[model samples]
Target: MAYSADGTRLFSCGTSKDGESYIVEWNESEGAVKRTYQGFHKRSLGVVQFDTTKNRYLAAGDDFSIKFWDMDNVQLLTAIDGDGGLQASPRIRFNKEGSLLAVSGNENVIKVMANSDGLRLLHTFENVSSESSKPAINSLAAAAAATSAAADRSANVVSIQAMNGDARNMVDVKPVITEESNDKSKIWKLTEVSEPSQCRSLRLPENLRVAKISRLIFTNSGNAILALASNAIHLLWKWQRNERNATGKATASLPPQQWQPASGILMTNDAAENNPEEAVPCFALSKNDSYVMSASGGKISLFNMMTFKTMATFMPPPPAATFLAFHPQDNNIIAIGMDDSTIQIYNVRVDEVKSKLKGHSKRITGLAFSNVLNVLVSSGADAQLCVWNTDGWEKQRSKVLPLPQGRPNTAPSDTRVQFHQDQAHFLVVHETQLAIYETTKLECMKQWPVRESSAPITHATFSCDSQLVYASFMDATICVFSSANLRLRCRVNPSAYLPASLSNSNVHPLVIAAHPQEPNMFAVGLSDGGVHIFEPVESEGKWGVAPPAENGSANGAVATPSVGASASEQPQR
Candidate 1:
């Protein structure tokens, strides 16, 4: 159930015993039905969710069709097309901002539709390619020119679209600079990666027919894109946005598509014949970007960035830690909030639990720490926010932030964030308002109430410089606020505002982290196991593309092949 501002009404959408879907509104006080929107969807899956950005609920069913219901009055707004033909369950997801809805299933195509600004086609990818293509489209030509002189040279341009609807190229583009002499036109090179016989205009790989992409997350800086499948995660793909007219487009060459057997924070079992447990639920990169930590099936494991080896493992806890975060100062220090309403601080240096922190009255949902003050803050389902000063693991200080006089009829959705270096100012999102406070003074600074009558904030974070505060609601809008004055900065659609490769209807970011070194760089982790990194416009006053990491992954292996390997063995662009 969801609540309206002032907690006067509650909203919920569920399937009745007769297998019919409905949106029921109730009075917050007496639990009386205030209103009901019938015919939510046929054969519904009972997993409907609210998107605060759009201020509505997303209802889907086994039929593959998704209906968007307006929350202002709980009415069927629009029904987007789905991929499920008749018997398949619907797989509809709203992008972070509700701008695009991605639907995929038994069909070879993953359809993405731009719902706002007039419905339009965003992209379409083939499910599987029977044969790869020849010397892939290597580059993109400059934008079409208006004059004949420019058209003469720029006629060879081609745009590279991926099978999964990743709008950008799968690899980097190498730009070719030439003189303005002979009617110079920008000629793009499109290099196809898949083999010739299997190339299809819109299909992905046949391997994906049975392989489920459990996660597709972006890095904190928004430069790298990560995808997790049944066997392994395709990590660290870089995208270069060109501005100069003469710059050439180049993409990194990749090896042939095949499954490998390995298991790490980014690895999965590729052999479909072998039954595997569900993929890991949570994954996080360290502040130093040196390791990837993941929690699954009650196990917490850390993998090395360079070797992808299991660096360490903590004591097995009772429940899985769905949310994990690395310490700001020490990569060895990790904070984990579990479904059990407890926070465990693990000391990687000794590979043991240094201390267990607890205070939340309900299950802990989010966790954050401040390096400047060496403190940890957590919020949870219990409707309470708690702060702890980390001295050693076993001994520390603790305090509970004040809350409203009484618990609202329902618990607020899980979302919280601590300010930048200054832990003094933090943001706690309640069902109706975003409360600002100074940790040191232990006083509420101000509250920004959502008068638009949207759902409560689901995800919130502060910029590296503490200049902006962003919060995402069930309405599908990310409301940005100014840290200096607590004023509304702006509301942005994650799909419209986020990097192209990271945009997807099924991708909903649950965690946001700022880059420790770069002021404007940040990374977000999604429920689909996707991570995206975004950088401000003027990083270092120069738009420098992120160089690929020299790890032993596919790209890294090609960059530094083993001895006795012929130079021709290197991946070709």
Candidate 2:
């Protein structure tokens, strides 16, 4: 419905009473329809900016050619007759300067057209991977010149090149961190700047398929790309190369000559080449990037970043497995959370289950190991809380922190208890109250009532130094509060970030996790199979937030904003 350019403009296309299809543009400024153009041979699938500089638009769909339109007049400018280019509806987007428009569809090739009069085929990049029966390019973005903001020093917009297989086939869609997804192409970014004609090829492993990319995050360092897929998470690290004589005022023509090969790093449970069942539902890496803890179907897996292989699997007791966690120390010691409302301590180095502790009446939803004392604290859906000795889980100290009593069967959500960095206090976010408790005395320190419109606190995470606590609301909003007083600090509403398919579900925030290093950055996963990433900004003496959902909507009609390296990169699949 809206695409972010300056703000957002609503776009639509449909048939007129005369049976001919018409393209209409709405001016958000005036809140009215601006103009209409009716020149497409068939129904227009969608409209994308054809020339970013001129603020022009392109309309295409059933026709064999992409129609260019002057946005000011909504008049047909020209149509590039791609007799074979528009077999399937292609998603199109123009680069920052509107110099290049990348289009990809049902075909195996991703075509880049120069925004000249003839719509010149500046480049045609194809997926050479043998795993693909037919390489389908899901999306594409043009690499920015990387020189826009000299002082701030951000790389050019990283284009996200994604793909997937044709629907109707049964493929591996497990939410694991993998290179590709089942029946869909995994999302990847072009590390270098825009080289419209460059066609570097890659070979991908067979049988790996990417369904749809949920989110793509490019690290501030420009050395890594984090891709959240339907079933898994993937990390792509750039292989660094020393710049020989690089100087300032770089030209856009030198992206290809400056970079080296990139490598993929994954912490997956299904590391066995032949195992088909192991997977990674979601995962988080430490600030140091030395450790990665992942949640599989019924187990927690740990991995060493250097080798990219599983070091241990922390499975719960027999027939009651669910989640696991590794202490911040990255020792072989692991904490296991069970579906049967129990916490188990394991000495991974010794390959032994240390102890099983009884605590809550409901399933354990969250577990954290304090770095100060190496103590393990667990929270349950039953609104119960407890702490355990690092040496043994049997040394359980249960504390019934004060909570607003709710009706039976309506208990608090999981992972709402967030321990502060001091390790002396923690915050308990319940359906009706945000309670802060002192760990030493197990006493309620403070409490803040939740606004009626805000969803119950299902998940919460503390900032690095424990200055602030970010909580995800059921109403698709993330509220921030000062850890000192539990006072409201800021809020980010991701209601607009959801894909159209999931937007209407109004599901609770199923998973809320933040990057350990990027304190202002976090991700929210919804029940409707959509994951949204958000980052903080300080524009005018105040903080603001932005979502990665730019063009991503429902029905393959929306698009995610390509702000980072993940936007322009292409994976081997």
Candidate 3:
């Protein structure tokens, strides 16, 4: 059973009717049956969820197959038939972007389906249990304890415990005794570690572990196909990338895909380093992408991106750093946004906070600096955009964001800023709208109302050359506009592209990074943890003949695997 996105409706699977499983939707506030979805299942349904972004649809999976119901039409949209690896109902999940749907029942396998093209099958992957984790004491934990011990007092023996996922099996750990100490509890050195003590390990059933992929990401290059399972990032060759689509067609000749041994990354942050309750990892990359910064409820760590070796660790006191950014001109100068509504200017060169700027009444959501403008602009969930004079870190001015055009009654939130290449003009996003602002005037030069057509607007940015503006909605819709006039040049949705098969996908682009060299080229991050390269395809100009305008003018783009994709990954332009 689950509540609707707005929390006003509740849906649940109940007894079968006429030998078919049925779903009842209840008015959340009054607990009354508002509607029922029927005629889809013959078995007991295990899971039910709503995807209201693009389709007013509710998805449910039973023992034999998974089904979808269009709540808007009160009709069955699609019924996918399969055992779904289940003796019972399968778990169902939709990616936040609402384009990808995952269903799993009993085994390690999961089926991924795309909602864009009549619920076509895109891929299937192995699912692993994230619930169960083994705790092995690390040298980093001993070192962490040693730093505090040495600062307080010198002791021959130190007691430590294995730090696991909040279970904290307290084992009285003594360092290894090289030459037998007078007391057995006394230690010589913390050279090796042991597993947690006196705790029963429980393994979850394979069926229970079914459900979802926790995250998505890119691998070493576009050539590799990576799969994530049980905290491991596996470079899978059997279930390959750009190799074969699930197609949902069965062939008797093909051998079953076999699992292979996989590689993993070292623990980036030890459990001992941060408060588990508040240990949310925050990450930022330096301007050159040479260094990586991470903070997880504790000290901030600056590490080498390639080697993943810790270069430095410094504590940013109380309230924690919610967001981090590097100075455009000086990477060493870090802008740390605090949870308690403050921004600290930390200078790595001198190893001290340069200044603390306070103006926002809430945590900072975005941070951008302009050495050319000699100022820094910050936006916060408190609906405040504050400017700070970088010279002395003085608050210059503050502005409360305006509510959306039709949402005057509801206060707006989630403001962000991005300075144009010139550093004179910047993009400001607040609520369901984006505007251009200049440093001196602080006036909205141009503004456009971003609609919640797909899902709520998630992100927006200016082109590399600052000629185009890009805004992405959560439901896989990307819009491009001319910054000069705010005219919509192109709008790309699930049905936007040619080669009909490619237009509908299981993933939608949410996060984007503009290419450093190409003004019309950028990499868009998909909700499924993959990346797609978007670049403008231009026709050869001997007499100035442009590509078809329907393909989105000269700035029109096609999506493909980025960072050196092979021939197959490159789509036909």
Quantify all predictions' global Cα lDDT against the true fold.
0.45, 0.47, 0.49
Q: What is the lDDT, from 0 to 100, of the residue 171 in candidate 3?
A: 14
Q: Candidate 2, which segments miss by more than 4 Å at Cα?
A: 1-288, 304-308, 311-317, 391-396, 401-406, 409-412, 451-454, 495-509, 517-519, 528-531, 541-573
Residue 71 lDDT in model 2? 58
User: Residue 229 lDDT in model 1?
Assistant: 44
Model 1 Cα displacement at 210 (Å)?
A: 12
- Supply the TM-score for candidate 3: 0.47
> What tens digits encode model 2's per-residue C-alpha lDDT throughout 25-62?
66643435577765666534433222223334544543
Candidate scoring better on lDDT of 1 and 3:
3
- What local lDDT does model 2 show for residue 204? 17
The TM-score measured for candidate 2 stands at 0.47
The candidate 3 region of ten consecutive residues with least summed lDDT is: 190-199
The global Cα lDDT (0 to 1) of model 2 is: 0.47
Candidate 3, 209: how far from true, in Å?
A: 15
How many pairs of residues collide in model 1? 77
> How many residue pairs collide in each prediction?
77, 36, 2
